[model samples]
Target: MQVTIHEQLVDVVLFIGARRRAAEAKGRHEEVKLWRYVWLLDDFVRVTGQVYRFEDSLRRELSAERPSISTHLGDHEGTLAQPVMDLLLETLDETPEPEQKQHVRVLIALVNFLAETGQLDEADGFVVNRWDYAPVAIAHFSNPEEAQAWMKSVAEPPSPVRILIGDEYFQFWYMREDNTRGMYRDYPIEPDLEWLTARGIPPETPSFATRVEAEAWLKSHPAHPYTFVAIAGEHYFAVHHPWLKRHSLHHVASTLEAWEERKRLVELDTDQETEDPSEGAGE
Candidate 1:
């Protein structure tokens, strides 16, 4: 049976820690430092805090510009990364530093291997929170079909909505209880406009029956790299975005009279720019 990437990571970290302890006991100070360097490299890839100083020193010594590590890992499926890590584990003891005396060379070699094989961007093996771009899971599943089935089981149905594609941004408009309109502006995801146009779906005509149906159609057709948004019965829930589909619908309160109040409250709660409509909107 296969293990999740998280489990593999636990195993690797434990192995490194044990090796460090062994080196310390044998008075192999140089080997201990090397193992500690590898340990810190692992930490650096996970997060940049505290490790930044070590990374900065390594960066200078390497005398090469490296891409900044994203807060979240990228190889969501771990298909490419698992092999490299497994090989690294196999060779950890035999891999030796050069006469130049750099402790981070082992990690540098791993990085170079990734870059050479067009696998650098796929270094991470986890899902992430879209809102915060933070890693949330090791992997949804090794298999795409399994992951999709899991997602479908828990995904909140996409709210019925109409899209208003604008010059620079778009809006998701829905009818309110008072028959007035409510909209979320500049939603992160964009609809496949060309696909819609081909099917004669204007910003006004041919609203999606359901978000799920829309996604199915889009997935089958895939005219462009875009998605849709909609409002729920009373609340504007943040759903449909990748990584957010299976999670709880983020509650966003917006009403005609309460628009400004909601905006104020939201601004106070988070530094994120308010996405609701202007005060007295749809009045």
Candidate 2:
């Protein structure tokens, strides 16, 4: 069994897009929202606030160099980002300032719900991340089958969790009538992440269609450093890229392949120990 975890960068982009949308749709809580979840280094992440900060910081950091805010913040000036920007500014005035860190997380959760519901940019690194490098969005799965299942699900039922990291970042979210649902809670388990505890969900299994399909999807994401941790007799893999396949974390075969190679080294070492009289002579 294997699963892929999304990178922190994707969340960063989503946060900005959410803020831009929130600002544009002032007094309209239904448009887009911020999601709060603890991110790397245990830093509590508030989507809108962080985006605002990231934008300000980037602008300030590169003020002398004149780096466009669009480069780091987002494409707020042009047709691509103008609408989102408008919404963000409009909503910012009314949006509650986080009284505490926990409050921020709940807000970010609501923002993600909006993103899932098609109110904001469809889940992707480009529109959400604010990069025009390519029209790219990461669609990853721990197993290749899950990726295919997700693609099918996206076209059909539309799985609620879209590559967002579970556990610390996001938890069970409930969508309101207007599709506003950015709220956060500590996870007993998040979306599809049930295998977290030994007693919770079962271990990850390779359910993707084929290895070729898996490779193709993985090849699509920008960064592709994959790691899998075996839990409850199952393996969970996290991805840095967006285009992950169903069984991206099905690396039991990978582990076996490594072990097989290591056995050869052990045999060679034994042969050398037995045959090398010069080494023994010195001893």
> Against the true structure, whose lDDT is highest?
1
The residue-by-residue lDDT of candidate 2 on 115-177, one tens digit each, is 333323322333334332211122333444554444443322221333323212222122222
lDDT, candidate 1, equals 0.38
Superposed Cα deviation of residue 116, candidate 1 (Å): 10
- Per-residue error (Å), model 1, residue 243: 8.1
Error of 1 at 139 (Å): 7.2
What lDDT does the true structure give each of the candidates? Answer: 0.38, 0.35
| lDDT tens digits by residue: candidate 1, 1-283 | 7543334445557767876897799998866765654554454344322122233444443464332232222442333333434334444435564421222243444344344445344333221122333222222243445534533453231112322221122232222223333334432322223233346423432235465644454444432123223333322222232232232122233322244555567688775455465756969
Model 1 TM-score (2 dp):
0.24
Q: Candidate 1 has which clashing residue pairs, if any?
A: 75-124
